[model samples]
Target: MGKSRVHWLRFLRLTSSFRRCPLSKRSLIIASVCVFHLLLVVSHFGYSQHQLERGIDEDKYRNARGFYNLDISDALSDSDLQTGASFVVPTRSNVVYITLKSKRLKPAHIRGTIRPKLRRKVRRKETNSAFTQYKLVTLERDAGQNKRNFASKTSLGETRDVYYKSLDITYISPTDTRIDSHISSIRIYSQRAPPWLSPKDVEVMRFLADANVLRIKEVSHGDSPTLLVFEGKTSVPKKNRKHTVCGGQCGVINIPVDTSEVFAFHLDRVLGLNRTLPAVSRKFSFLHDGQPCPVVSWDASLYPEGLAAGLSTVRLTWGEYQNSLKQRCWHKNISPKPDSGCFTVHHYEWSKLALFDFLLQIHNRLDHSCCGFRPRQEDVCVELGHHAQCGDPNHIQLTNIIHRDHNPRHLVFTNNKGFFDRNEDNLDFRLLEGIKELPEQAVSVLKSKRLREKLLQSLFLDQTYWESQGGRQGIDKLIDVIERRAMVLLTYINAHGIKVITMHV
Candidate 1:
């Protein structure tokens, strides 16, 4: 109270002094003092407001950071639970504390939560939308209709299994019942094994299909397909093994776009020709961006003269080839004279090759000059000017006429690049120009109307090829082409009066 009284007396004295001065000067001083006091009061209020705002902003920032820390803590807790480890998070002021806890994860829970999601994603990637939609519709239909008819029809479990099998999304182990019991090494991916495949063929196919590829290199010569060396045990006996690379197991990898080799292999088998190497469609992740490629069993015997010499090809001009076919060299175990201009290949081999090439339109061996058919500009014969050389029928040389070194009498069909795109009007008659006979077995197959069924059954063995060619519908179209060609061939045989002889050799 005394302090307040003293301040009031001092203020009164100051006012009295101001009153003693001139009236105008005193009023000016009083107005200046009032303005200065008002400015001071305004500055004090603004400072207080700024401090309050700063406190609120700091609180808000702290809350945001607290939420961020909580999220990190949750992630850490998940990691800890997965790894069965503990973590310590430092405490901070104005931040909520998150407790770290560890829990054991059950195998069933993990699989149930993660496997289905992963499987679904993979299924989507592997299949198109149309296929998935079809499967879904099938499942819905089966469930709706089969529920009441289960007693008379197939069981519900079997119906569900069929749909699941069609998806082909389930994982199959290497050792499964799909593999043939006698030939354990070979895996049969389809529903049934192809009866045409022998045990030795199955073994070689298994090596080509599933063996680990060690290295890939060109066949040591220009204008040759790539060869893939596989690291595994081959089915060949050690005494008969002649190949030095890849421990005698190797495969010729055809390009992704060149699927004719696979078709030719199946055709050869179905016709009972048994000349083409075992070829199966497989995918190499390292090559062609994982597209399906035709892998053919490689026979080192084809390169007995070494890889630099290329295939054991029979060097014969067109006239010479036709002349040798007419001479019927080495028929019935009779050898040819030195001046006969006949090669080591037997007579029946040409007949078989002619019939085979005519059906498949493989001109690389018999008609390298595109003389038999109207070739497009993109064809190798036209692009490389081979078609122009057809003028000199006596000089034009045959190419890709390969045979094994040890067995020159029997031809081994390599580079079986058949064409299904050729129309009936443009059939290659030149291939069968000099042929006088066709294999009885092969002609019988053509005569029978069961060609489609046999081809389907044989081709279904290679699941990769079956699916790669757009499944059953696409495969049926290819068969339809062959069937048309077969009809044409049969008509030609009847018109030419070619003998359908049994070629046991």
Candidate 2:
């Protein structure tokens, strides 16, 4: 009471002073300004103290409010995996198809589907409207196997088929507008890959193709034999979700079933060379307009050639093509050093490529008429260029180097359609002889009897994919020839003695 009296006395004295001085316009204005400033200062202090006591950070409050307002339901609609959870009538459907996705939050009512007789307590508050406000009560399970059929983060990492019907969902809560039921949604992280292709390159390609995500930036001018080298980016889905596949620009080669590209990729993986671009077996399905179409696997560009008019495309071999490269030597054109004619360091990679071709009995390495592009040496498209030049494996063009931009000294074997000849004994090592160097691992793998056995077993496991494509006989022959070639390679390496060179240049 004494403090209040003192404050009142001070306020009266200030008012009396203002009254005495502020009769004039300038004095009245000065007094008003002083009072306004004092009020602002007092208001700011009160606001700060209130905020501190309440633990209310303005920035954090705004951020949290915005987060709660985010509509996850709309995102689920745009995703590849469909949403299954929803509010329905008491008598819902018996079977519900749910996508096996990751870290899905399901409602407790879902449990009632399995155990209909069980009752659980639900705290509900009545609102002014028909709806009821309720909080979510959840029992989380570990990531591994559980009897509850609930999966936690990282527990259900793999894709599995879940079978349930609509009737399986029990109504744990009474149907009332007041009751705020939990909204459950599934988010599929990784999906099952195709059985026929490798996991990375081919699997992503297939996904892009199926999702209509591929946009062909250009159909290269040098592409041949109906093979289209697609330079495109994987379109981001409208769902705003990340994918397990490639999203940025990458190269994809479309080739026929008879081509050795797929086999070469498989062999590359088996040998651990990883020098080849990954390949997946894809049949023609869509048109340029992204419409469904049934068509043969052949390059549309070949229709302009005179030879294509009468030739049976299936019978056309890479060995049959002859071009200007045959008349001249590429060594004179693409010498690595300033003026040396000896094999360049790239010859070491050529040696590996040569041995790979020899193992498959492929001789199109130097044949332009084969399924290779004869681009003007300057206008070569890396993605669409020829795999082999037309002169000698020892004299290779710089552009023919695969992954040239990334690894200049290394070779990338592509367009491998002309392989697996009937003659298993005719193994050519001309290219391998140029470098006179072989990967020690390649030599060891070739020499290991146990490795050969494992390779045969793996090949047999992959036979299913080939057999589905009606290439069982070809796969069997390929396996047998590979075994024979391994023996031949072992003998050749042993007789000549391989030298391993480890120079970057």
Candidate 3:
């Protein structure tokens, strides 16, 4: 109030002084006083508006930080502020905070007497039901459990009350038998045989499945596979009796874990590579605890010098093998000179063997020392220190380069212990070394992307094998590995410009 009085007194004094001046000067002074009062009013109004806006902003900031209790100034480092970095601050009023409390409820315990409800029997007209009634029958017996139960029964034999339930047998009438026979005939006519298997292969598979085992003999060479000698059927005449030690229909049974032989045979037939022998999965009641074993058709020609003498393998070093590849031995019926290190095998055979081995990753034949792949500590090459001998690759002796006594020009893929576990990155390209061409049919199958389908159809023929391998799901996993390897092989062929030719020879 005092300050306002002082300003009023000073204004009156100035007006009095101006009144004493000339008329024109008085008019100018009045105009100037009016402009000063207007400027003061505008400045006061602007200051009030600025104070109101700042209060509104502070209120909003407090409301936003109430729940999180976050200080924007502290949240950002001094460096960030100095650099003028802009950040968005959430100011939505609809954000709700909720607190959840969980409590465990104790179970209530109540004691009470219970009485059984009696069910009254009711008689009604018989109605046909869609569900068929089946009696449970045990397929396999637990030997230990049965023995224990038998012992318990014998101990309480005299004291226990003997109760015998009458056996209920419903004999089927002749009409039912006739209907069943008709149904079975229809089923047999409707079901088609596997298209991939030949008549001879089917016959051999059946013989391996049903032929009675005469004896089990272990081979002296290779992995020492057990030889199952079966009694030949009277209907079929034996041809290679004198050649084989078994003198009858025989099967080479490998360990139960060697399921690759079966897969190798199926792949062989599917790709039309018929290099591998026909093999089937069979369970021998007296062998390997009755586990399913891969049984390959026994070929006595593989051992012409008898059981003591191992498989008739080609004696060739790595250097000689490479030289033979360059020479293209026995190609176009052109004989190679003795000086030209050429084996009996044709040049095209190497291509087929390389493709087959690459798909299956069978390193026993070409890369026995595992030169082209990273060998694990447990691998045969690593265990035997063969991997260390890879430095002298030229002198490395090739193992399992097998050929039949009668057919020396071709190779029979025996001991086909293929590895499905090997990864694509670790593939042994050494098997494909010096291989300039591949079989057209095999390459086509791989390119067509029907390898998995063909293998499925071919492998499903053996029921024992199908069930032992956990059915389609398990078999598909194995095929997936092969399919991936096939892709890698196809890529390799394209990159290397390997020729694809008809290998019908």
Candidate 4:
């Protein structure tokens, strides 16, 4: 009340003073202007005081609520990359930010651009004959619980022919400390079969080495002279195809081993076995942090059983085979005999394989050792021979060689390395000692001029491949050895009076 009274008295005094002095028009106008300016200042002070009471301070919430100029590069680190995490990716030019809403119930919103490093060119269909190229280029939840691995899905429209080694990806989420967090674990996963592969059993393998797929699934390491097998896959043509289909040999790869494996397949095909795994020579390369690394690979197939297992399945060492043969006696009254029941059972099939090994100069197999065999059929073996051994239990007749092939006589030939290393003069014939008959069809094919031509052509298919592995000259020697060996086998059969097993193919 006192303050109000004092303000009223002061106003009245001011009015009285003005009334006494303002006899002219100019003085009265000046007094009115001063009073209006004083009222305006008072109203501004009241507005400021009201704001202070409501606690509206922008500086206090500046850190928690504001736009950020962060790019994807700023958020990601070396650990975020799957393959070439050590590589330095270029920074993205796009902008991203986070927004902190004022309402207590409303959560913070985040937004960002996803820019991955360009690994390969995605070809864009062009109207002109010239091709146009487009570059097509994931996340973390926990230290251990949240693995940042990623796989390609057709739903994402990532089905491109070119493969990507690494991707630069950025994302934003409420769980992130900053609105924009770099996802270091971005990876591309896909599976595709190579175009050149023809076997229906292994056609799916082409995508295993597709340039666009990720290759970190299951890398195998073996004890041989440093073999690194990389497991890979490419996207299937069908959009809805599952990415996790069993890859078998179609999705597996290795360095030096594949070279040998593919060569062996060629050998098998030329020899008319048609039992070896399918494989094709392929040149593989990739970029690591922008550096190029090229490799030669043989994309081989994984079948009902691989060549390694097939070569040794039901096989026994030569000594073991000899001992087992000695244990089998056909008659109760007769002494145990080595050739009684065992010799006639696998003679034909073993003879064929012996010839095959001799031609390739593959010396790893021996009589005491049975190198390969098919799955056992007890009824089939016992019916064929009462005392047949598991490795070579049945005679493969020329008329029906393929009918009961699943039995022990199948003898899948595999791992055919060691071409020109062993001395050809002292070629091992222990595997041929039991030969009593030969397949006439196989023998005729072997003696045919076409066989020689096929062998020559097959050996020449990978001239560059053998040369790279220090075996081009060895391949030439191999051809010479094959021709000479074929003639020797025919001569031996004629001299020994071995009967021909005639099968009409």
Candidate 5:
């Protein structure tokens, strides 16, 4: 008690004196302590003045888009954050009322009704009927608060409501045809926005969903029809116009499909079967750490017709691949050839030759429209001039797709090596768009080729196309788009500790 109590008393006195010190010295001591504490805090929590930002971090995950990334990078897009967006539910009395900015629509009024406005713009030439409701939306920040990230790409947070309903609209139409005549079919899709969502976010998404509504109905016709899909009033392009391209409504709607059901829906079922090619490689094997191979059998590159529908040319690249033909674990089951060019590398799985071929088929759809009688070959003829190419025992290897309607969803060869090849060729192959990996169940669902073949015959040959022995150039294109996106997504998945492969096309 003597020594311990004396020390304790002294410590307490010192603490009290420090707390009760005079202003100037106390302030300096306190500031010094704060600076040390602040430095520690800064090291722990404030490494980046900006990295902590939720929406703006560049090192975040972003979707892999096939086209030029007109959308935001590695951040939740405007499409992802839907607030105050309006939708109509067909109800017994009236469509379910989605009160977005109810103060403006006024639910209190007895006769109050909200209808989907044809907010997307149509082209209008002077004295032309195509131009209707055309205008530009400039998302300028209010005075003083203007900054680069704020002005250049409207921050998703600041996007309170869509400029669509609020902005002044100018009507335009094409020269010859009347607006009423040109509008063949208008499809409007409405969904109740999640209640917790911000009104502005909802407005942006509702506009996008509604905008894609028209596209979901368009048939994969020629360039003119595809152009019509874009140029039409309901088209997102027409809506986006001089304003940011695919901006307001678009940056948000890329819903990530679940991995289980990669080939979940039929074309008609999804995009309601109407929306075309959703958003739309290669290998090296047969070597022992720069070793050799026994034989080599490779195919030429494949392509797609998945662009905006007009005849746009597409090219694919596999970069550098192996040249070694020295085969170690060559599968004799594939062919009579002893050293079947396919080799099993630990990571690079397929031999360079096999990878090239794998990537090529994955790149093309409508069945590698080289010279074959595979499922989608006929579609190639329709879209990209006739190229009667067939998957061969020696050359073109047939792939099994999940749609099974006409084409098999499975690859021509499935190795434990873990290679995946998906694409956007025709109706069947088109469904695989934007998906990073084949649904875990696609393999199981595709067990019976009978159902798939029947579906294919009906959807592709009978329901969609028949009598004309032709396929669209779309098959190869479909394969290419899917392969590219899958690579990007797989890259992200790998980073997150999810197992995946580079996967051949």
Candidate 6:
């Protein structure tokens, strides 16, 4: 009976096991699937975020260049310029003054006619022929503030394809990118890019330019009570009377440089970077009262994206435009080697700027006993005057006047007899040979104006009063008054052994 009972129980158990439902197994499977999907979603979001940052990093890395990028420059329309406005922006680009100290080099001069490249003969235009206009941008910083003061904002930009012939020179480029050899720290402050352009686009464009100054030195020594200068090139040990820009890779921006003063960029200001890209470099420096007043210091915030952050990549690509001037005039393969030099408002630069071609014209003049007019080159080259110890100590001499540009650069020399004075835009009306004559009253006015200008520069520098008064009309009138009587006054200054154009700003 016991054995029979055990068999019956076993048969019942087997039936129960078979009856267990598949629904329970399905529920377990569903739970597992939900967990796997949740984990995948989280992983995907994390990965997507990482990828985005990587892309941005790649962008910044590739676009890192040695110079500052980002600006608030406006492209002035013809109407705007015609209206006597420099640009469309209501305010000027935010400019900062950077005071840098190095050897103040002399400027070069051309001993020839100012206009070297004669205008091309006019030709009929084809509809398809494209014309281009090239222009350079410029900025001026205060003369006194080096690392001593910083400008809050800077404004700078470009005007390209401003002139046209057969080609559509009227068309501004879709992309406006600019690079220059030298720049005032104030101008870079204005280079911040607009939101429309990508964060790295402006920076990338800057990196692509060949315009650069070698990190020449990164340290310097200055007079007592003077703050030290930050340098960009040399890594050597400290030395007395040495100057440097701190060998930085040029990726930092808006760094609160400890001090401030006024600074000018020789490498850029005179070159077409502020006017037209003449291909290479023209740089100079100014010394006031045998000493420099301010030293230009760099700020990181004013530069484009990565540059102000102290990134390392600082290489520029030399585009075809860089050598355009050279290719036109020079055959570098010439026998004694082609002489290429820089022309500027410095005494030392003249050595490089003067050419045998110009000297030969000066030396090889023919008799002008009877002629319609002697060639200006042979007949007109005269000594305007000499600059001896005007601004320099220990006797640095610079002879200023109009002469010739022997090289392809066509530099100008001899203007109103002062070194560092350029007569490019009729700005230096100091040349009074044009005025027929000067009345005694005009001479008196000239004397008073010069005396007042020299004595009251502080009044002229009063921005609040001047800006409130309005455009340079007052100064203009004074300039006109001086110009009319300049012949006699200039003669007087020359006779007094005073280099009028070489006065300290």
> Each prediction's TM-score against the native?
0.62, 0.40, 0.60, 0.40, 0.23, 0.19
Best by TM-score: 1
How would you encode candidate 5's per-residue C-alpha lDDT over 312-392 as one tens digit per residue? 221111111121123322223233244443322211223221222232233333233434223443343334543433222
- lDDT by residue (88-127, candidate 3, tens digit) is 2222333222112222345467776897788675443223
TM-score of 6: 0.19
Model 5 Cα displacement at 73 (Å)?
A: 36
Stretches of model 6 off by over 4 angstroms after superposition:
1-89, 92-474, 477-505
TM-score-wise, the better of 4 and 6 is 4
RMSD (CA, Å), each prediction = 28.6, 25.4, 25.6, 29.9, 25.5, 30.1
lDDT of every predicted structure (CA atoms): 0.69, 0.39, 0.68, 0.40, 0.27, 0.27
- Candidate 5 residues lying further than 4 Å off, grouped into runs, are 1-126, 130-244, 250-366, 370-439, 443-505
Highest lDDT, which number? 1
253-338 per-residue lDDT for model 1 (tens digits): 66676688988988998788899999988765434445687888867777786554667888999999988988899999799999
Q: Count the backbone clashes (under 3 Å) in each candidate.
A: 0, 21, 0, 26, 91, 98
lDDT of 2: 0.39
Per-residue alpha-carbon lDDT of candidate 2 for residues 211-313, written as tens digits (9 for 90 to 100):
2223322121221222223323445553542222223443443323334665666676666566665544432222211111111122222223222231212
Candidate 1, residue 357: how far the Cα is off, in Å = 0.9
Candidate 5 has an lDDT of: 0.27
What is the overall TM-score of model 2 with all chains considered together?
0.40
| Cα error, candidate 1, residue 142 (Å) | 49
Query: In terms of TM-score, which candidate is stronger, 5 or 6?
Result: 5
Tell me how far candidate 6 lies from the true structure as C-alpha RMSD in angstroms. 30.1
lDDT of 5 at 388: 34
Question: Which segments of candidate 4 are over 4 A away from where they belong?
Answer: 1-213, 216-228, 232-260, 286-312, 315-348, 367-409, 459-477, 502-505
Across 1-505, the per-residue lDDT of candidate 6 in tens digits comes to 9999999999999767646748787678679999999999999999999999999997775555312222333233466447643321211233322122222345477587576777665554455332211101011221123212222222111112111122332322211112232322111222232222222323322322221333222111121011212222334554621222333322111112110100011111211111111111111111111111222323222222222222121121122112222332222323222443312222212222221111111111111111111223222222211122123212322222222222212323211111112122222221221122222322343454442332122122222222322324543433343244344444644555532221110
